[model samples]
Structures are given as C-alpha cells and as structure tokens.
Target: MGLAGLRIVLVEPAGPINVGSIARAMKNFGLQQLVLVNPQCDRLSVEALRMAVHAKEILESAVIVATLPEALQGCVRAVATTARVRDWEAPLENPRTALPWLIEQPTQPAALIFGREDRGLSNEELNYAQRFIRIPTSESYASLNLATAVAICCYELAQYAESPEIQTPQETELAPLELVESYYQQLESLLLNIGYLYPHTAASRMEKFRQIYNRTHLQTKEVTMLLGILRQVEWALKTPRKDEKL
Candidate 1:
C-alpha cells in the first residue's frame, strides 16, 4: 500500500492539463487517491478528460478541499515536494530516501503534497507536511512542471511498494496530523497567555517550534505526554495553586 495509501495533494492547481496528467501518472503508478486544495481550474473538464485517457476515474474521484490541512486531516504522515529552498532547518531530502517514510505505516494514511503550477506551496502550506523532498535538476534549468514532479514522486512511491523491505519494525505508531495540530493550537494559546509568545510574532515563533517537533517523529504517547503538560499548565492557570509557578 505504498502509492495506494498515499494521496497526491495539489494545492491551488491552475491548469486542467497538469491536473489531468497527474491523475494519469497516479494511475500508472497504481496510486488512486488524489486531493485538490482550492483548485483554480475545472478538474472534470474535457481538457482534463483528454489527458486522463483511461485514468479518467482518478480525475473524477479526486477529493476537492478548501485547505491543505483539510487535505491532510486523517493522514499520519506527509511529504511535501518543492523546488525552492525552505526557511526551516530540516534539510531537503531526495525522493527515494524520503518517500518510503510515507508508506511505511500500512494501516495509516499518508500524503505527498505538491504545490501550485506557478508559485508552488507557501511556507504556511508546507507546515502541514512532516517531511520535505526536492527533486535534483540542473541548476541552470531547475524549474519542473507540476505534473512532472508528481510523476517522479509517484514513480518513487511505486518502486517502494514493490520492494521486499517495505515493512520494518517500528518504535511506535506515528501520531496523526490532526492530533499534532490540536497540540499546536493548545500550545500556542498557552504560550500567548504566559507571554512566552507575543501576539504579533507568535506565528513565526511557533513555526520554529513546529519544525522542532516535526523532526522528532513523535508517537501517540509522546504527544499525550506533551499535551498532559499543557493541560497541567492550563489547570495551574485556572486554580493558581500555591506550589506551582504561574
């Protein structure tokens, strides 16, 4: 369930031809799930259908959502593809090394997110993915078409699926994006209340924290522990207990 379990997420795709070609590539690699975030063109138009050919079902069945987070709701793992340099500390990884991390959890859903045809994914949009991958191209001509990037990543995913080492022992089950998001929201509110984060600069500061946690590959119990600490902070803020520092 490598490519099969991964959703090909396109954020604000403006071209029907690109979307249709991506759908066709997905079908070629045995990938069925496709999610579109705020698409700018008609995914079901005659243009899309013409490019999809025999893979028209993938185009027809694509899930259309309003935001990147909504596209990744239940997914436990996600890898975002980009050609630009990121402000975050995490190093950009190659597709072969990064993609297997997505399909490793057979029971859990995962995602491979691609950005817009023109501008690509913004920093905020990229925060939704735990891992980041960039395809190596000639420095003189580094631009890659939206569908071309998806085709490359989809091929890598298909290769991972066919390999015999698809399964491996795990330390713990990876936490879901929704669960991590809940922690982020609560943590942000608590930090703001304590004055650790200012209202104006909190968003940027919190992204640093997100980068730290995303690299940790946190498990379910770990998130629960951190949330427990936040909950204790919440309790202390309300009761103002004598032993604890507010």
Candidate 2:
C-alpha cells in the first residue's frame, strides 16, 4: 500500500529515546501513521523530542491506544517483529523478504508491529499478524536495540517502496483486518453455542483457525461470504418457530 498507508505500531514501548528514534525513522522513510499501545514512557518528553529532531511532528501526532487490536483498527495486513522463533507455523522471514508484503495492497492500510523493548512480542500478540519478521543477527550477539530494529525495518520498507515490481497490481485483494476480525468473533460465538469450543479451549482452538485463514490468503469477497454465512446462522438462532409456546 506504499508508504502512506503503512502504520508503525509499537506495543508497550518503555523508552523515550527508542520511541523518538522510531518516529524519526518513520519520517525518513516516508511513513506517516504511528500507533502506540499502552506506552510506558512519555513520547512527547524532552528526551524524545530531542531524539526526534526534525521529525518532532511525528512524535506529536502519534496515536496512543490501550491495546494492540485498537492500534490495528482498520489494517488489512500486518507483519510483527520478534527476536525468537515462535511456535506457530508462520515462517519468520527476514525483513527484506516479508516487509514488502505489507505494502503490496497499494490502496489499503497495513501495519508493521513491534513489541516492547525488553521482551519482544508475546505469542498472543504475534497472532494478530499474518506475517512475522526476524532481522538476522549474529548468534553470539542476537539482540538488537528497539530503535535500531525499527531503523532496519523502515529502511527495508523504503527499499521495497522504490522497487519497480511493487508498483503493479496483484490479482487478489486482502480484506480489511477489521472485517476479518468480525468473522472471527462470529465464528467463535457460533462454535461456542454448538459446544465445539468451550471457553476453556476457545482461545487455543481459535488460534489454529487463525493460522488456517492466514495461510489461505483469503480475499475480501471470500471473507464477506464467510461473514454472510455467520450472520445467517445468527439470525436462525435468534428466530422462534411459530408453533412454539410464548
């Protein structure tokens, strides 16, 4: 979706220096949207503004939210960064290989999600993303500072933005993450109603469902069809038979 539609989401970022540097990197790369989830540090603090330098406006204009899902409101595609290999089958690709996918939608909004400076993303947080990016570093010194990591990813995004291949349109379009999320909520409630998913196991079972849907690269219309079916089922469940006693 090019740089304009790309969002940089930081989850629980605790350092003003890191937050400011990330804002600067975003500006240097032409990206405009920034969403912070429950940040511990004051993003507008003097230290942050000093680090931001000429990109101070980015720091000032960032959207702050209480949760990751709120940060990702209307996004259609997202790539979450993690330091360790996760348990899920989703491949942890390098930024060069994966970041481009976030911008391929051209007209839609996409996101690059970063976790807290200390622990990276929890597995539950990682599930929100369809793709994952792991910057390759030496095994002896694998840790990259949060700001440095953001700089590397922003550079890769900028590189991909300039690629000739990215300008062409793809055959299929991804549904907005909001729409897909509605489908998930509906599917989960239905599964619960039918006893296919108990509250105790629903979260884990739904994770498997997420992996399947993410792998299929489901398109907008396909998700719409699924949502329609869910709506119909909900209607039937709520409707009463004429012969039934009041």
Candidate 3:
C-alpha cells in the first residue's frame, strides 16, 4: 500500500523550480511515478535540479507526453485538481472521497493530474477525469500555487496509501475512460442533432450533463444502462413512421 506505482501528471508546467520542488515532495511522501505533459520550461534545468536535490531521480525518470490523453493512457482512474467552481462541471470533492478508490484498486494504475502554474486545467482536460478534487483555501486566495496543491494532495494520498483499511473488498467496477468518453460524445451528437442543444451552447450544456453523471461515479452497469436509454431516445427521434404527422 504505497504510491510507488501511482502516476502523478503535471499538465503544461512552466516553472522549473516548482517542477523540482514537486519531485522532492514526491520523494518525501514515497511517490515515484511522475508525468509531465508538454512542459513549457526545461524540466531538467539547473533551478529544477537544485530544488529536486536528492530526489533528482524522480525528475529524471518522469515521462513527458505531447497531450493529456497520452499521459493517462493506462490509468484506470484519474482525478483532476481544480480551484474554482465550474458552472456546468460536477461538484468537486475533497481528496478523502476520491483517493479511497485509488488506494483500494490494486490491479489498475491510478493518476492524479495537476494543471499549469498560471491557469488550472481546462474544461476539456477536466472532463477526462472521473473525479475533481478541490483543496479548501481562503476565498481571497482560492487559487493555490501548483506545487503547493500537489504537495497537499500527495500528503493526503500518502495517508490512505499507507493504511491497511484501504485494502477492503471492492464495491463496484468503474467504467473505462474510453467507454465514458464515448458516451459523452454520442450524447452530445444526439442532443445537437435533435436541437436539444444548439451548437453554440453545446459545450457548456454537455458539461452540465457530464457533471450530473460523473458525480454519481457511475459503474459499468450504470453506464451501460444510460447508454441504452440514450440510444433508444436517439432512435425514436430519428425513425419515421408512415402514420406519423409532420
């Protein structure tokens, strides 16, 4: 029960110092897997190296990817870190609610995603995650430094990772990312086709739907059920009967 194999992804990190600090903190908390997506600054720079100190190995071994999807390739579960409340996005939970599923799953890899230093993860990126985690902070300074947020989350994860209670029996199997994503895509297209959602307002409206379903943390069975319902509705709307009135 450790974060030794769990991946931590930083999307578009710009600060070398922050990168190094995160590596050091990861080492301190016993986390090893680090992933960076299209880094803006040299991740191996002197400033970063200096900050990493003895944890330079974590920095050196970090995988760099061209996009968020590539970084999340093999992860069974992924959580996104966000600061502000998204209008159409699902309600954000604390680290406690989200981390348990990760710790309990021994067979599949899990990922924790942190966004850029200047701006947090985009809605598209956030949509990729099954759960959203928000660190409680003062309203005046709701946004925390990227590294600080990472450290706090990492620490909380460490607590659960090291606990024996996290080894309990699994309750339900989560739907695969591909399956969930496909559902969203199909739902969006069906809605647009039926004029339920206009092209101009599709993204925001779809996001609200995403929030509602995601917040339920739907299992594979539930997802399949919903997909069936969506397909039926789509078919009914598209099929023309001879007796139907225009």
Candidate 4:
C-alpha cells in the first residue's frame, strides 16, 4: 500500500519555504502528487528549491490550480486540516482514525487538504470535505505550522501503509465519498424543507448529521438503507392532499 496516487493539496500557501518543506516531507513519506491552489509565493523560488533538496521532482511535478474544487477533481476521499474547533464543522478526527480507510481502499485515491497557514480553511472550504482532521495539541497553542501538520499526518499515513494487519476484507466494500455526500446533501435539503432545520442554524445541525454518519463508517448496504429512509421521508413531506382529515 504505497502512496503512489494519493494527492496532497495545499490551498493558498503563502510561504515558499513551507511549500518546499512540505514537498520534502511528502518525499520522505513516499507521496508523489502535490497540488497547490492559488499559491501566494513562487513555489519554485530559490528558497523553495533549496528546501526541497532531494524532493525537487515532487516540486517540479506539482499541479497548480485556481480553486480548491479544481484541485480536488478526481479525488474520491478528501480530509481537510483545521486548527480551530467550529461547531458547524464535522468532528475533528486524528490521522490514525482517518488514514486507515485510505490505505484499505486501494481503488479510490484519497486527498489530504491543508489550508492557508494563517486563517486555516474557510467555512465553505471545510464544507467541501466530508471530514475534518485536528492535530491534538496544547490548548494554549492549538495551531500547528503547516509543514509540521503535514509531517504528522503523512507519517501516520505512512505507518498504516507499511502495516499489513490493517487490510480490509474484499467483501465489505466501503461506500464512495460521492455517494455518501449525495446522501448528506439530500438529507439536509429534506430536513430543511420539513422545518427540522432552519436557515439560521442549518449548518451546525447538519454537521451533527455528518458526524453521526461518518462515525458509522457506512458500508454500501448501510448507505442504501440511509438513502431509502431519506427517500421515504422526502416523499411523505412532498405528498400533498386535499383537506380530508381523519
């Protein structure tokens, strides 16, 4: 289980040294793909080049994109890194809980997203991902440097990749992120339509739903059951009738 096709996306990285160091870390962990979105500094600057050292090939092959969605195209699973604890974001999971799924599922390539060093990922950007990761640290200084965060997550991922006991059974197919996302989208819309969630508090309420389902680690059959439940609820809400009270 090599990190052959996994993609690491850095959104709006402003520090060239951090970028280069991230490349070096990726090389250390055997990751190849590096994507940058709207980088503020020259990724190939002399400073970056010097820091990359032996990982210049990763730097040279890095794909630059204009936006986050464009950078995440073709990725089946995406995990966003964040330092702040937001009530509306999915529950922050560690790399240990998250990385296993990536290595276990070989067919779908996973993407790890690191936000800007200063502000971290925006609310909208966080919504684009199904899950969020938080590095456990002292509360006084919870935020970690971009390169350090990358190194920690990559190291955890590499450890899982090297271990053989973490292998997943072939019969228990993991549901694709797209399918799970669609279910969440439909669930949220239906809940909003039915008055269970209001516009003012919709995001936070929906985040609870995300956390519950993600914790389940839903399989294909489980997802089908959930979709069926949502469909029934939606149909009940949509079906209108004349005033014929029983």
Candidate 5:
C-alpha cells in the first residue's frame, strides 16, 4: 500500500557494501524508492553491486541528491533514525511503532531517513524529520550497523504493509514539506528582526520552534495562515506607528 510511496533516504553513507545491502533490504520489503544524500561511497561500485544481488535495479534507479532537504522535497511525512538522545521534545520510538506511521496512507510520499555509518544524524538533519526512531539493542553492544538497522526497519515496515487495521486514511491533506520549510525560514527572519533570536543562536533556537510546529501537522491552509501572519509582522515592523511621526 503505502510502501510504494515510501522513500528510504540514506544520508552520507560511506560504505558501498552497506548501501548495497540497504537497497536489497528495501527491495525485499517491496520498497522501490531509494534516495542517497551526499553519499561518500559509490552505490554502483563492485562491492555495492555484489551485495545488492538481484536488487541491482534499485541501485541503478536510485535518486541521488546533495542534501537531506532535497531528498525530502515532496514528502509529506519523514522519520529519521538516530542513535543519540537529545534534549528535544520529540519522542524516540522503535521501528514497529513508528514505521507503520510512515506508510499509514498510500496517497502521499513519505520518507525514512538514515544517517552516516560512523555517526548518526546530527541535530540539524534530525530537525527535518517529524518523527524519530531508535532501535533497541543490548546494553553491552549498543551500536548497530547501518545496513542492519535498515534491514530491521524494513522488515517491520513490510509486516505492517499487509495489515489493514493501520490503513485508516488521513483526514486532511498535510502541507508539503517545502511549504512548511518556507514558513520556518520566514519565521526565523521575523524572529531575528524582533531580537527573539541572535545570529549565533538562531539555528539551535529554531530547532525548538521546528519541534513545536511539527507536532501540529499543519495543513496547507494552516501554513499559509502562518505565513500571512509573518508577512503582517514584517509589514507592521517596517511601517511607523501613527504617533511615531511626532
């Protein structure tokens, strides 16, 4: 169902073997979309192709982008897998619980993001995702291989693909990520102008604002309303008050 619309996004994957294995896992679970963001290794390398096996087509047709935002261009929903915990308000869920949410509806495109092999997603990259997933592992050896992580998540995603209970359609059309992102840029500028955020601290402060708005799942009109408010604020700040002329 929604598997068709799901995109597996790997950010800066450094190992061709891992990238190839991930492609195979995706194909095994009926996923067709693979997005590689600034990959450090060649997806078509001999090692990569060897691991991909019958899934070479997945590698051949994979979409390569320069950045995470570009990878998520038209996606309405995104979930990022992380290994580190931060002070943010977003909850870190496991694969089964969160993976299903990605494919809840088949109509719109969604994304599941994985980070670099050496280090997981940074806080800035994590901000682009509305949901976060952290796989549970043993206390002794907590780290997971990049390819292994993708396989585990893919298996869970495939399980949910056959289940009809979670297929309830979304009520409203959520705003495209591009629209939401534009609002963030506008809001940040407005905040800077009003001194709510300083030049050095804008990025961190905006992460909080992102978390707040992301939780609301704002629709297109809702985002438009917010943009209008920001525009009015910008205008109000530029125009002198009636008494200021004196």
Candidate 6:
C-alpha cells in the first residue's frame, strides 16, 4: 500500500512555487493529503499551478486551516522536521529512521509537519509533534528549501511504504492526537489553578510534560483515564473538605 493516510502539513508557508512543487512531489510519491496551516501565499496562483503541473488536483484539494491543531485533527501520529538544535529532551532523528514509524499505523491518519520557510517551527509549535527529524547536510551549506525537504521525506516514505519487513506490529490502538491535546489543556489549567504553574512559566513547564507524555504513545483508554483523573481533581479542588466545613 501507499502512504494515503499520511497528511503533509505546511505551517505558514510563504512561497507559492514551493507549495506547488511540494504538491507535485507528493504526487510523485503516492501521497495525497496536503494541509496548509495559515498559508501566506495563494496556493492556486499561476506560479503554483504551473509548478504543480499534472499534480494540480493535490493543490486544489488541499485543506487550509487557521491553526496547527485544526490541521492535525484526527491524526494518531505526528512527526515534525527541524534544522536547528534545541534545548529539548527529544533527540533529533534522521528521515530514514523516523519516516517508517508514521506508516506503521496505516489504518489511522498520521501527519508530517513542515514549518515556516523563514524561521521553521517555534518551540511551542514543536510541542505538538511526537517526534523530530533533522536531515543531514554539509556543514558549509546546511539550509534546505522547504519543498526540497518535503520531496526527500516523500521519497523515503515511498521507498518503505510497502516493505513488510519494516512494519511494526500494532499491539494496541493509539490515542488520537486531538484527544491527547485535550488532556494537556486540562492538565495545564488544573496545574495553574492549583499554583503548580505560574502564568509566566506554564509554557516551559508544560513543554517538559509534553515531552514525557509524547514518548508514551498512550492508548485511547489510557487518555480517557487520565482525563477522568483531571476532572475529578478539578472537582475536588472546588468542593470543600469535611474537615474544612467543620
């Protein structure tokens, strides 16, 4: 099978030609889903359409959303590409090693996120992904065009999409990313209400929490259990204890 379940997400991409080129590349690799998160350029512009050539259908059918969360709706796995080293707990992996994992759950939707052409993904944006990638290049010229990066990853996806030897056994149904994101929001609110995280520091502290949870690949039931605990804790904080009433 091909990578039909994988969604390619571009975050605030600015170049029309680049977007078109990515669509054409996706067509070449048998990928169809294209999602644009607040694109800065008109995807259907002449330049884009011309570059897309025979792949114009992919561009026309692309999903445009206002936020990253919206673009990632219903996905079970997400891998983000980055070029710079950051102070994060997650180690940067190569495209060959990490791309295969995305297709392991072929029945469920997955996402591959590429960031802005100028700055790439921000720290907050990076938090949304379960894994990270950094394509190797010569030290003298490390920068890569956005479309080039997508094409390279697409090539890798096509190469391994049908390899039975690379498929990992699915032991359980993984939780949807939206479900896990909801839990994170609730957990952050509870922590802030209880003064565990101040307004000034909640984001950085939550980054650590995300890094921990992202690695777990929590199941759907596991996330529900976690949400239940958060809701109960929230209720407890509002309710007066028997001793306090006395």
Task: Evaluate all candidate structures by whole-model CA lDDT and list the values in order.
Answer: 0.89, 0.88, 0.84, 0.83, 0.91, 0.94
Give the per-residue lDDT of model 6 (tens digit) for 108-172. Answer: 88999999999999999999999999999999999999999999999999999856677566657
Query: Candidate 6 at 99: error in angstroms?
Result: 1.0
Model 3 misplacement above 4 A:
138-143, 221-246
Better of 3 and 4 by TM-score: 3
Ranking by lDDT: 6, 5, 1, 2, 3, 4
Native-structure RMSD, model 5: 1.2
lDDT of 1 at 102: 83
Identify the superior model by TM-score, candidate 4 or candidate 6.
6
Name the TM-score of candidate 4.
0.77
RMSD of 3: 3.0
- Per residue, candidate 5 scores C-alpha lDDT tens digits across 35-125 of 9999899999999999999999999999999999999999889999999888978999988898887877678789999999888899889
Q: In candidate 1, residue 117 scores what lDDT?
A: 84
Off by over 4 Å in 4: 66-70, 73-76, 85-98, 127-132, 136-143, 164-171, 220-246
Which residue pairs clash within candidate 5? none
Q: Mind giving the per-residue lDDT tens digits that candidate 1 earns over 78-120? A: 8988889877687899999999888776678899999988888
Candidate 5: worst 10 consecutive residues by lDDT? Answer: 163-172
lDDT of 4 by residue, 1-246 (tens): 348788899999999999999999999998999999999999999999999999999999999999987887766567888888786635788878976666566666678899999999998677657678888999787778999999998899889888867656574555666677788889888888878899999987877777677666677778889999999887876676567454
TM-score of 2: 0.91
Residue 89's lDDT in candidate 5: 89
Question: What does the lDDT read for residue 216 in candidate 4?
Answer: 65
Q: Candidate 6: which stretches are off by over 4 Å?
A: none
**For residues 1-246, what per-residue lDDT tens digits would candidate 2 score against the true structure?**
479778999999999999999999889999888899999999999999999999999988999999998988888888899999867677889899998888776787889999998899988888788988899999999999999999999999899888776665664677878778888888999999979999999998898899889888778899999989988888887888788887
Give the Å shift of residue 55 in candidate 5: 0.4
The local lDDT score (0 to 100) that residue 128 gets in candidate 4 is 58
TM for every model, in the order presented, reads 0.94, 0.91, 0.84, 0.77, 0.97, 0.97
**Which candidate leads in lDDT?**
6
Better of 2 and 5 by TM-score: 5
